[model samples]
Target chain A: MPEAVPDQFQGFAVDKKENWNRPKLTSYDRKPINAHDVVLKNETCGLCYSDIHTVQANWSPIARDNLVVGHEIVGKVIAVGDKVTEFKIGDRVGIGAASSSCRECNRCKSDNEQYCKTQAATYNSKDVRSDGYVTQGGYSSHSIADELFCFKIPDDLPSKYASPLMCAGITVFSPLIRNLGGADAKGKNVGIIGIGGLGHLALQFANAMGANVVAFSRSSSKKQQALELGAHEFIATGEDKDWAEKYDDYFDLILNCASGVDGLNLEEYLSVLKVDKKFVSVGLPPVEEKFEVSPFTFLKQGASFGSSLLGSKAEVQQMLDIAAKHNVKPMIEEIPISEENCAKALDRCEAGDVRYRFVFTDFDKAFTA
Target chain B: MPEAVPDQFQGFAVDKKENWNRPKLTSYDRKPINAHDVVLKNETCGLCYSDIHTVQANWSPIARDNLVVGHEIVGKVIAVGDKVTEFKIGDRVGIGAASSSCRECNRCKSDNEQYCKTQAATYNSKDVRSDGYVTQGGYSSHSIADELFCFKIPDDLPSKYASPLMCAGITVFSPLIRNLGGADAKGKNVGIIGIGGLGHLALQFANAMGANVVAFSRSSSKKQQALELGAHEFIATGEDKDWAEKYDDYFDLILNCASGVDGLNLEEYLSVLKVDKKFVSVGLPPVEEKFEVSPFTFLKQGASFGSSLLGSKAEVQQMLDIAAKHNVKPMIEEIPISEENCAKALDRCEAGDVRYRFVFTDFDKAFTA
Candidate 1:
C-alpha cells in the first residue's frame, strides 16, 4: 500500500437524519483494501435517475446510513492489494452498478450476476465479503472495489463518455444482446422509448449494434435530437394518436426508458412488437406504478413484456468496448462533484432538465487536497 | 363428387332468433366443395370449451346467423375437389380450430396460419371465399374445409383421442413447442394449469415430449388423476397457499388451460415462472375479463405472460404425431351428437362435469342414415 494514499476521503452522503431527498457532504475514513480489492481515484461519476431514487427513498430502504450514491464511475487505480494482478497503479478502471456478486452462485457462473441473490450494488448496499461496512459509491475522489467487479477502461474511451456508459449504456445494451443471442444484432428493429439519459444512449447503442433504431418520445420536441443520436426515425406518441396502430408489428424489440408509465397505454406501445418479439422495460418507475396489460395484447402478437436490470460485469465490459469502437459519445452535461451542484443536479433530474445525463467531474477539488 | 353425400345435413344450430343458449336441430343445404376443398363425413366431434363459448356466445358476437358450432372435428374424408391431392375417400382427417386462412398471406406461408389476419374458424364464421353463407361445423354429419387447413390423422392415433387433440391438444402444445423451439422438448419443466380437457392433454404431450410435467389444479383430489396422466408432480393451488413461494422459479413453461382465471391469484402463478420462462394462457375466459399484472412480476423473473390461439395445421399434425408416438390417450366420455345430447354436453362442460373431454359420437344417428 502506498503511504501517500490518504487515510480519509470526502464524499457526498445520506444518513438517517439527513435523508435521500437532501443528502449532505461528509468525510469518511478509507477502508483497507483486501487482497482482491483495488482502490481507485475516481475521475468521473454520473448522476443517474437511480441516484434520485436513493435520495427520494424510492424502492428499498437505503442499504446503509451515510451512503454515497453513484454507480456510473470511471477512475484510475491508485492502489492494488498484494494479490491483485489484473490492474496496477494508474491503470484506468471502471465500476458499474454491481460492486460485488456471489461469484460461486449459479447466476454468477452463468454470467448473469446482475440477478444474483446476494449481489451488492456500488451504493446503498452491503459488500458481499464484509459485514461491518456498507458499500459507498463514487460520489468521492476514491472508490474501492473487488478486482473482479472492476473493468479495465479501454484507452480509447474518455473518462467523461465512459462514466455514463456504466448505467445508461449497459442498461439498454444488455437486453439487445440477450434478445439477439449476442452483440451481433444485425437487421433488428430497435425501438427506444423516451430520449433521456438511457434512451439517447439506447439509440446510439442499437445503431452501433447493427440494428435499425427508432426513437419514441411523448412530444415531438426531441425529434431532431433523437435523429442526431443515431435514431433512423422518430415518432412522438403524443403528437400521433394512431401511431401505435400505424406501426403495428413493426419492431422486433422495444426498449422502454421512460419513467412512470402510469397512464401510458402500454399495450398500444406493445403494438409495434412483431410476433414472438420482446418489449423490455429497464426504467424503474415507482414500485407501485401499474402497467396495464391485457391478455389480448400478449395473445395477438405472441409478444412478451420484460424488465431488465443493469448489465453483468462481462456485459459492462462489452458495452464499453462497443462504445469505444463505435465512438458512442453520450450527450452528457459535466458538473463539479460538490454539495451545491449535486443538490441542484438532483433537483434538475427530477424536473427532467438534463439534456441527456449529468457527469460529476473535478474530483480533485471535491475530495483530494 | 359423391352423389351418396347428401345435400341436406341435420345439425344443432343457433340462429339470431333462437340464440346460443337454445340451439335447435335444423337441416341445412350443404355447399359444393371448391377446387381446394374437402368434404368430411363427421364421425366424431369433440365438445370443447370453445364449443360452449360459441354455442353460448361467450366471446365476440356470433359471426353467423345460423352457426353450427364444432371445431374439434375428426372424421373420414368423403369427397375432395379437383385440386385437392392429399386425401382420397375414407382417409381419416381432422379440422382443428382454424379451418381456413388466406393461403397467400405471410403467416400462411410461414406455417403460422393460426395468426393469419383472414383466418376463419370451422364454425361461427363466414367462409373466406364463400362469404354469403355461414361456415357450419361438424355438429352436422358433414363439414367442408379448405385443403390447406385439414390434416390427415395418423392411423395410430384413435379417432376418440384424436378429436380433442384438434383443439385442446394443440392449444397447449403450441406454446410449449414455441417456447422450447420445437416438439423435441426434452428435460424442460412444463407446468399445466387446470386438469380438464386442455390441461390433461398438455400433461400427456409435455410428458411424451420428454419434459418433466407438473400439473396444477384447484383441489388435491386431482393429484392421483394427474399422476395417472403422466405428471411428475401435482399442485393443488386451492389446498396450498404457499405453493408459489415453495416452487418459485420452478417452471420453464406454464400452459394455463383453465376456463377462467378471474378469481385465481395470477401473480402467484407468474411467480412460478423462471427467468426468461413463459406462462401461456390458451383459455378464452371472457372478452370483458381483466387481468391485473404488476411490472415487478415481469421484472423479477424476466418472464412473460402470453395467450395462445389454437395450433396451426403443421402444429396440429405435429401434436398428433407426438401423441401417437407416446400412445397418449385422452380420458374422454363419449356422447351422441344429437340435439338433446349436445345441449346436455354443453351444460356439463360449463359445470366442469366431464372426466377430461367429451367426444360427441353417433354422427350417423344424430345427423343422417
Candidate 2:
C-alpha cells in the first residue's frame, strides 16, 4: 500500500455545540472501495428534505455522529474494483437513495431494489456486504459503493440538474410513468400537487409523456413558474377557495408530494378524482399523520388511493432517457457545497422557500481538503 | 289512442294495517316512456339489499315510496319507439341500477355513464330526459328505461341467473375483469371476500377466467359451497386465526364484498396485497361506515385501494357472454314475485341467511293479476 490515507476530509456536520442545533463543515473519515465495489467522486448532490430530516432528526430517527447524509448523488466513477463490468474509470454516474440490495431477493430481482428487505440506505445505514463499515453518503467527497447499485448518468444532463433527478425526480417519475403506462402511452389528466422538488419534476415528466399536466400549489408565487415548466394549468389551492369544489371529480391521477399535515382532507383531494381515478402518495409525512376517507369515497366513486417508493434502476434510467428525449430538465437552484450553505439550503427548504429544488456543487473539497 | 293506454296496472303496495305493515294488491300507475326510452315486460327480477332498504324506508334518502325497488330487471322489450335501435320488441334484455345519464357529459361520452352528475337510478331517482316522473324499478310488471342504458342478455343463460348479473354479478365482475386484464389472462391470484351474493359469482367468474380463486368468509359453513362454486381455497377468517397473518401480502387482487362493519381492518387486507396489488371494494355496506388507513400502509408497499360500480352495458353483455361460454352459473335461491316470498327473501338477505342471491321468479301475477 501507499502512505496511510488521512482520517479526515472537509464535509458538513450539524453543530452540536449550540443550544439551537445547526450543521457546519468538519473533517470526516472516508472508506476505501472493497474488491467488489467502486468509489464515486461525487460532483454534486441534491439537498432534499430528507437530508434536513436527518440533520434535524425530524420525522426519521435521530442521526448518529458522523452520519454524513446525502443520497441524490451525481459523480464520476474514479475507481472501480476488478469484478466490475458495466462501469469503469471516468464514467459519468449517479446514485439515488438506495445504496445496496441483496440481488438474490425477489424484490431486487424484479428491479424493485428500493423495497428489498435487506436494502441499505446511502446514509445512516449499514452496508449489506461490507464487514461492519457503515454506509456514508454523497455529502462526502468519495462514496464507495457496490458496483451493482451505482447508475450511469447520461452525458447530456448536467451534474447539478442530474442530482435531484436521482431522488426527487425519480420518486415522482416512477409512480407517474408506472401507474399511467410509462413513456409511450399517455393517459388522461395528471395532477401534480405541491410545486416542490418532486412536483416540479413530475410536471415535466407528465408533460413529457404527453399528458395534460395540472399543477396545484398553496401559493400563487409558483403559478407562472409551474406553467412555464410545462404545466397546462396552475391551481393555487391557497388563493382559490373554490378550486377543489369547481374541479370535483376532474383528474384521472393526482400525485401528492406535500408532507406533514394531520387529518389532511385527503377526501377533498379525492373529491376531484373521477370514477376509476388513482390518487398516489409518494411523500412520507409524519408517522402519526392518519388518512381517513369515507368508504363512499371509494365505493360510490370507484377511485383508488395508493403509494409508491422511488423508481427502480431500470425505471430511473428510462426516466433519464425520457427526460433527454423530451428535453425535460428540472428547474433547480445550485448552491456551493460548503458548511454555511448546507444549513442555509436546509433552512430554505424547511421554510418552503425553494422555488423547486436545491443542489449542492463542488464536492472536490469534500473529499481532498 | 287505444283508450288512452290505461296508465295503472294491478300492483302491490305496502299498507299500514292494525298492528303490522302489509303489502296490498292495488292499481299502480306506470311511468310514461320518452322518445329515447323503451318499455319492458319484466320476466324475472332479482331481489337485492337496496330493495329491502327502499321497502322498509330505512335508508330514507335513497328510498322513495312510489319507486318499484328492484334494479336487477331481466325483461323482454314489449315496446320501443323510433329512436330505440339497440333493442327491438322481441329482444331479451336487462336493466341495471342506472337508467339515464346526460349523454353530452364527458363521463357519458367516455362510457363512464354511472358517474355522470346527471345520472338517474333505475329506482328512486329523477329522470334526465323527461324530468316528468321518478324512475321506477323492476318490481312492477312493466318498466320503462332509456334504451341506451339497457343491456342485451345472452339467450343461452337462464333469465333467473342472468337477472342478478345486472347488479351483484357486474359489481364484482367489472373490477375483476378490468384489473386482471380480463378472464382469459393467466394465473392471477384473486380473493373474493364475503361469499354471499357478489362473492359467489366473483368466485365463479375469477375461476372461470383461469385465475386462482380464494374465497374469504367469516364462517366455515360456506366452505363446501364456495369450493363447489370453484374457489381453490376457503379462508374462514373466524376459524383460522392466522388467516390474514399467514397469507399476508400474498394476493394480487382482493374483491371485498362484505359490508356493515364500522371500520374494517382495510390496512390488514392491504398488507395482503402483492407489490402493485389492488384491493377493490364492491359492496357499499353503509354510508356511516368509515374506512381508516395510514398513509404508510399505502406508501411503504405501493399498494392500491379502490372500488367499482356495476359494469357498463357493453361490459355487462360481455360478462354474460363470458359466463355462458364458461358454463358459469350463479347459485341463486329462487323466490316467487309475490308479497310473501318477496318480504321473506328480503328478510333472509338482510339477516345473511341467503345462500347466494334470491331471484324473484313469479312475474305472471304482476303481468295479469
Candidate 3:
C-alpha cells in the first residue's frame, strides 16, 4: 500500500540554483513516515558549525539543490510508522547528527553505528533508504527519521535548552566517557580548549562529572563567564606565553574543542597532559594542514589522542538522563524560526557573535497552522 | 666513613675525549657497591637499537663523557649490599632500559616509575644514587645497580633467550597489557607490524594472550616464518596495494612495531582498526618527520593512537611472569662479548641482518678474567 501524503510544511532551505545561492523560506511537500520512521513536529533546532558547513557547501560537495540543514533537533512526535514501537504520538523526541545506518553491519550491531561506512547524517546526506532523494534536516516545521536514530527526550527538559545537547553535548561527552572510563570521573582533572559553544557545554559536563575543569581560550576575556559556566580554572593560551609549559603533566584528560588551524600549538597542550593521560579532539581542522605528532613525545609520556563523532543513540539517552540528574543546563539564546531570522543567525554564527548557541523556535505557524 | 672499594672489573667504554669518538674494548674501573645496591658478574647482555642510538649519538645529546652502552643485562649477583633484600649472592637477575627512579614520587609509587622525569637508564643516564659516576650497563663484567631495578630471572627461562626480554620483551608487552585492557584478551584480533625483534616477541605475547594475530610486513617473504612465530594470518602491504582497504575495521588491537620512517602509510593501517580500537606503537621514528593525523579521520572512526615506554619495574617483573607462564620466548642469536663482535652486531642490527636479537656473552673474560 502507498503511504499517505502529509500536509505541506515550510522550511528554510539553501537554494543552490538561485542567483546568489542563499537560503530562502519556501513551502515543500513532506514525505510520509516509512515503516520504522517517526515524523516529528519540529519545536526547536540548534545551529551548529556543521549547519553553516552544509548551507554554504564548505567541507564537501553538496549534492542537493535545495537542502534544509540542522541536526540538533527537538520536537513532539506527531506520527509513528507501523514498525516503530519505541515512540507514540505526543512523545517528546530528538534526532542528533546521525539519522540512519545499516543496522546489519558489525559496527551497527556492536554499539558503534556512528562509524559504520553506510552511516547517514541528518542533512544533505544520501538517503540510503531507497538510495534516492536526500535526507533533509531539522530546519523545517517537520522532520522524518528512523526510529533507530530518534531519541525520546526527557519530559522535564525544556526543548530550547535540550536542542544543543543533542549535538554539541554528545560530541565531547562521548570521548570523555569512552576514553577516560566514565563521565562520573570523580576527582579527575579535565582540560577543555576553545571556550565557545562546544567548549562551554563540555566544561559544564566535565564539571558535573565531579572533575576539576580547566578552560583554555585565546585570552582571559571569558574568565568570569567560564568560571560561571562551571570551569574551575581558565587559561588564556595567547595571553600567557608559558601557560602550556607551566602546567606540565597537569591534565588527566584534555578535550580539544578547538582546531589547530587557528595557530594553536598542540604540542604545548600535549605537554600539559599527565603520564598515561588522554587527549581527545572533537574539532576538525582544515584539510590542508596536517598536525605533526612526535613519536618521541607521545611514547615517552605514554599519552594518547582520540576523536569522537556525535555519539550513539544509547549515549544520547544517557546524556539526557545525566543532564537531568545532575541539573546540567546548556546555555543558549532562542531565535524565532523565520527565514529572515535564520539568515541573520547564520551570519552571526559565522562571525562568532553569538554568546554560545542559537536555537530556533516558533514552529506552530510553519507547520499545522 | 667512605665505603670500602670492591674488586674492580673491566668493560667496553666510550671515552668522549678520544679523537675518533667510538666505543672500544678498553679497561675501565667499575664503581663500588652501595647500600641497597647489587653487584653482578655479568653473564649475558642483549644488543638493542638503543645501543646504536646511544653509541652513535643519533638521538638526544650525550651528557656522559665515559658512557658504557648496554641495558638488556642478565647476570648472577656476586655481591649484595647490607640492605639488599630481593637478591642474595649467586642470585640471577636482569636489568632493562631503566635503572633507577625517585621511588617516592607519585608516578613511582603508583607503579609508573618508567615515566618519572628523573628516571635513570642503565647506560649514559643520570644515577639517582648518591654515587658520583654515571650508571654503567651490561657490557662490563661487574656492574652496580640499585635493588629496585633488579628483576629476578626465572629458573626455567634460559639466560641467553631471556636477555632480550628484559628490554625488547617488556617494550611491546607493556602496551598490550596496559592499553588493550589486561593481557588476557582472548579471541581478539591483533596486528603486529614489522616481523623482526620487537614484532616477533609481540606476536608471541599476543598469541599467548589468546588473541588472533595478523603479521603485516613489507612483503610475503616472512609468511612462513611469521606463521611459525604465532601469526594466524600474514599481510604483504607492499605487494598488495589494497591490503589496508580489504581489511577495513578488522583488528581490535594493532601494535605498530614498525616505524613511520620506513615509509609505512600509517593512515592506511589505521583503516584496519575497528571503532574504539587502539593502535599503539613502541618504536620511535625519525624526529624530523611528523605523521599527519586528520581530525576528520580520527573523529569519524573513533579510534585512538598511543605510544608506550618500556614497562615499569613491577610491570617488568609481571611481564617475565607472564612470559614464563605462557612459554613466550624471544628469538635471539648469541655473540661473544668482544669489542670486535659487539661492533659488528651493532652494524648488522642496523642492516637488519640478525634473525631477531643479538645477545653478547663471554663477559667473564671481558671483565673479571
Worst 10 residues of 1 chain B by lDDT: B14-23
TM-score of chain A of 3: 0.93
Kindly report which residue stretches of model 3 are placed more than 4 angstroms away from their true locations once superposed: A1-10, A15-21, A26-32, A56-58, A240-249, A259-262, A365-369, B1-9, B14-22, B28-34, B130-133
Q: Can you write out model 2's per-residue Cα lDDT over B1-369, one digit (the tens) per residue? A: 111234764444543222112444556766666777877778888877766665565444533343457899887887876688788777888888888887777777776777777888887788887755666778767777887788888877778988898888888888988888866746778888888788888888998888988998888988998999989998887778777778754688999888554545677677777777788887766555667666677754688888887777767777887798888887788877777776677667878888778898878855572
lDDT of 2 by residue, A37-152 (tens): 76777799997777776665555554456567788888877777777888878888888888777777667788777777677778777778775666677777767677666778
Name the regions of candidate 1 deviating beyond 4 angstroms: A1-9, A15-21, A28-35, A80-85, B1-9, B15-21, B28-33, B132-134, B238-250, B263-266, B269-272
Candidate 3 displacement at residue A368 in angstroms: 8.6
Per-candidate TM equals 0.93, 0.89, 0.93
Would you list the rank order by DockQ, best first?
3, 2, 1
Go through the candidates in order and give each one's DockQ.
Answer: 0.53, 0.54, 0.65
Residue pairs clashing in model 3 are: none
DockQ: which candidate is best?
Answer: 3
True contacts kept of each: 0.44, 0.78, 0.82
lDDT of 1 by residue, B1-369 (tens): 553777787788888533555568888877667888888888888988877776666676777656788888888888888989989888999987777767886667887778776777788776778756668887888888888888899887778778888888888888889987788778788888888888888888888888999999888988998998989998988888788878866788888888887876767777677666777888777666767766666765666677777777778777877787788878899997776787788788888999988898988777653
lDDT tens readout by residue for model 3, A199-281:
88888888888889999898889999999988999899888998876787678889988745457676777777888777888
